[model samples]
Target: MTTPVSLTIPTPAEAARWAPEQIVALAQANAAAARQLDALQLEFQAMKHQIEWFRRQLFGAKSEKRIVDASPHQMNLGELPVPESSPPPPAKDIAAHTRRARTTDYAAGDASALFFDEARVPVETIAVANPEIDGLTADQFEVIGEKVSHRLAQRPGSYVILKYVRPVIKRLDTQAISCPAAPEGVIRGSRADVSFVAGLITDKFCYHQPLYRQHQRLGDNGIKVSRPWLTQLTHGALSLLEPIFTAQLDSIRASRIKAMDETPIKAGRAGPGKMKGGYFWPVYGERDEICFAYHEGRSGKHIAQTLGTDPPPEGAVLLTDGYAAYERYAEKCGLTHAQCWAHSRRKFFDAQALEPERAGQALEMIGKLYAVEKHIREARLVGEARRAHRLAQAKPVLQQFFAWVDAQFESQGLLPSSPLTTAMAYVRERRAALEVYLSDPEVPIDTNHLERALRVVPMGRRNWLFCWTEVGAKYVGIAQSLIATCRLHDIDPYTYLVDVLQRIGQYPAANVAQLTPRLWKQHFAANPLRSDLFEISK
Candidate 1:
């Protein structure tokens, strides 16, 4: 069926009765509306271009180092010929002392040069007291002065206070789990504090220092432990905890909503420049628990294997940036892929950094989108409430915003070699993922939660440099995971590690959930300082 057009013009007879100017005015009005529509369309396109540029700079394939501005002093004046025949300036003449004015011009009558000499004398006094009396004796007074002089000895600098709280692990005489025996006289040792030993390996050896540094401290504190022995303990602890790590990975696979991100760690086994970097991929659940995986590579194949097969268990949504690997993994796993809008917005923002005018127009439009998100976030809406609110307030902005993107991308020479072109491409490619969050209450507006988590890698990187081996990198991943998890739970990492090392063996495996910072908070919430009861004896 053909639908009839909506608008109808007045009949010719009625049109003829109207003045000629009225007809012209009507035509002008229509032209003005068309012009306004065209302008709005251009503004939208510019916004999309700006947003896309930032996306590529951040999460897209276009990875290039941003050029830093040179300081004024750093600017070079082009090469110049050496100066020829420059002569040194002559010295200035000085007034002679004899010619200079003086106040003492009068001559005195000749008199013998007076000299006064007097005999010098020295006086000394001594204090005395009986040895058994309250008053000081001669010997006692000498002793007191000697002690005072010693105390008054000059020093170069004031002492500095070294504030460090020692770890508090009570010596519990306990039995360890029995395992198959090594050869005879192997000197089998039971590392009762396995978790702490893990921390020692991760925090000290793999990350900040070698095991010997820790061993030296132990020795200084009168604990006679060898570095080789500590290394053995670390290996043993990791071996014991491997199963728990595996179980945690299994738990992460069970989650419906997961956020995944990867960071590179230099694995020392790989040859210099030829070194293969390991990836710390954390797959976080919406619930209190998280699972971390350290993989040898950051390829799509690794991601697919880690996240599992296609047609992922029900309610699965994988959130990530515009990394193509993630897209492939999502496709292979049949998991719904959600791209970060922050990544999209960043594209434009980055372009704006280079091209201010185009970026300004783009930012104005994006600001509207953010304003709406900010409103919804401030309202603290979640689930259906959030989805409904976003659909109503934010959906139209997104539609208009994307439509603008489409028009810009279609135009020729509008993007070109400009980074804004890159930004535009990202929006067009991931438009569907960008919009999914508006429809689903569970989906976040962005993947910032996970990105923020990944920042720890860079922070710790600045301090400790790089991982020594694949095993060492894996240990770092484990420690960073626990420390980050503790931060998420609002627990002090040092205290948490110290407590775990001291009590983990006695802590029931079934109650491991309680050790998570969130749960630990509840147990100690009423009396947060309860852990302080176990302090190091001076």
Candidate 2:
């Protein structure tokens, strides 16, 4: 009852019925239709990939960790691939051994190092008077070790003000007043004490508490302070630490191998009530130090500015993600550039949904590279020895992986611009860069450490939002650089800031490197300067 929708195709006989001109036109039309169909299919697949990406962003697991099981319900598109494994090594049985409790003898004589560990907390003592002791004389009842009990206690409003009340005295002969001058503070003629400044910067940068929120907290605590005053205090505290940050930054740049990456921050004003974007180029040094250098633009020139325009020292290497700027910089500067393996693996990860079998094969190969890195860490290999092991174990795996990728290209089964082909092309192009880590022991197989250090930037942006100005963003970098480095060195950021803030004003400019957290840990951490209130409590 309905009209039939039949697809028509032109055959040789149908063309034969037409004139010569008509036949040529029909053949051109048919070829054009084939090309159009291919384009449409490519577009369709791209849209599907984008839709799946958005869905993952909204609902899927954020971790890129390889999954042990595949095709779990509700997780089809972006599920990570776990590599196929060979048979496990045979287990060897061991004789059972007795385990000891962690607590044991420690701190004998003048030594504090102990086999048994204890929490590092302040001790508060109180004398409990016994009624029996009140009735007995000192000689009548011998004093033995008293029973000890412990309970953890905490109090709110823990803030304390350091009051340095100076005694006023007058000379009888000259009528001159004399008192000890106030100790060096973080800022000149500023009411904000070093402890207060340290806490403000630490809370804002390290803890992501914005100035407005901090102002509210102070108001709630009965210490009324202006928001502008807090901002000024932060600026002053950061300015004091700039020299040390520079020294550490130089140390990072001078390392034999280091990581570099860029992250965006909304800094400066675009128009009324709007912000412009800037980037933080964070460099992670081999010594575990980091620096967040702020820039108005992300370009290869900035990388040169950080690493230098000159040819680097021999054997110097730069580790980075697959960013073009780093590639250009390293090439222009005549430096050895190594790419992250994890990034190459990520491309295949995204394509797994479309080309499950092919992408799975690629992911499994890359996963073996990670497995080698894990074993390297487990063995605690370093220097030449680590390099040797990687050459012996990791090099062969890499060779085989590249061979597979090359075979994929020669087969020519993957469509041009398709996800599978694109991933394979990315790996094939960077084969040399990917293999650089295998040759150098110091260069990490990935930039995960650098990413971890720079995480504070993005996490902070969520709470504190954007910087009011580009200068403000630079100040943010300075504070974060020091705090992040403090974390790497296992030093308490609050204590480090308090000591350095008080010491920096009087410290020699030529020897500012000693004020850096790495050097300060050795020079002054044993007996650091303290707030007057804390000293009195001691």
Candidate 3:
């Protein structure tokens, strides 16, 4: 007694038959499942790409150069039927030639010329006697012209502890004791003098030396200085320099066109044995002066605060990377916003690993733009000439590039999350900003200038690691700003810092511009007191 199961086979019509409500529900469920699958796939792809990016950052060629030999005419995405033509020649049939030998000129002329122009450099002459006439008497030796050869030399810097002896003198008539007031030192009570403080700041910021190491160096030279004391001296020096730094910032802000960028630095302020991230926002002025400002975070508010004014001086154009923060700040301030073409190209360059064909096309087009820039630079075109050159050469290339981008979006088969799609969106969004360079000669095509100026922050970070506190980071920014600006003007940073430190206390605050590296070069560089560390050959 088990009831036999009825074995039945359903007909095609019965199998296909279903209630209308059931059919609709089944179709809706199928669509929902597909949608979920697509979402998961998109998420997975995004994660994969992110991991790949990190891997490349950790281990990849640092250079972004891409070499392509094909002509621009060959860079089309269309597929067409092949036309009948002569067959291509085999590689073996091609002609070959011997490689040319490369040579270098190593003969740097006249050793004396190196120090000849340095009037302040002390010269010591060593006389060499003729070996042929040994032990020649004064009567035998004849007074003749001399032959001299010069060789550059160096020695470790000498440090000394100056003990100022101010003798007390009494006036005979008034019976009042008076002594020449001791010359104003950078720090009144500190043992360190202006030169010492300037050297410390220069060594720390310009040479990327840490205070503890500098302290040890001094100890090795028989001068035992505590790290804390050195730190205090450094802070004091920077405090004196703060006014100059502020003046430079104001000058940079007043410029009609400027470039800006930021780099992160680890500042030890979170807690003991911990560090917090901070940023150095560097601004490049029209006259090639660079100013770095430190802030706890990279926010639009910090940018606004740094500028210290709304509606940035008329005709102001701020060139920067396509950071949304800049856009908001610019909009609120009524400043002209220009984006970096190099940044746009960088996006496409990174995408090359994922989508070579599309990325290469974008890179080639962008390369054309850079080529035009190279021509403009080689010609030293400026103002109207530069704008006209861009209009004539770059405008057409840009038109074609944008047209290609539009066509890519309109054509089917590109996923929104694809690297190429993302790059296209990035360029399209910043198209107006990117084109600003074509219209204005003062506006650079990229913010690479400011980025290069800010590189010192990262390089110094590599050597000195983190600043002890947020305030320390700010001081670092102030010192680095002056040092970098000095370097930009081909001025010796140590000399500039030392002279500025010695004179800044007495310099009128209203005329601080004279103390800046630019004006200092024009006025004080020719002074006999200028340092001969690396004097230029006349």
The best candidate in terms of lDDT: 2
Model 2 weakest lDDT span, ten residues long: 108-117
Tens digits of lDDT, candidate 2, 247-326: 99888877888899999999999999889989999999888899999998887788877776765778889999888889
Query: Compared to the true structure, candidate 1 yields what TM-score?
Result: 0.58
lDDT of all predictions:
0.59, 0.77, 0.76
Which whole-number lDDT from 0 to 100 does residue 236 have in model 1?
57
Error of 3 at 313 (Å): 3.7
**How does candidate 2 fare on TM-score?**
0.80
Instruction: Identify the runs in model 2 with alpha carbons over 4 angstroms from their true place.
Output: 1-7, 10-18, 70-157, 169-184
Write candidate 1's Cα lDDT for 163-225 as tens digits.
Answer: 121122221223222222211111134422323343464555335555666666554533444
TM-score of each: 0.58, 0.80, 0.75
- Give the alpha carbon lDDT tens digit for every residue of 497-524 in model 3: 7678778888888999888887889989
Worst 10 residues of 3 by lDDT: 528-537
TM-score of 3: 0.75
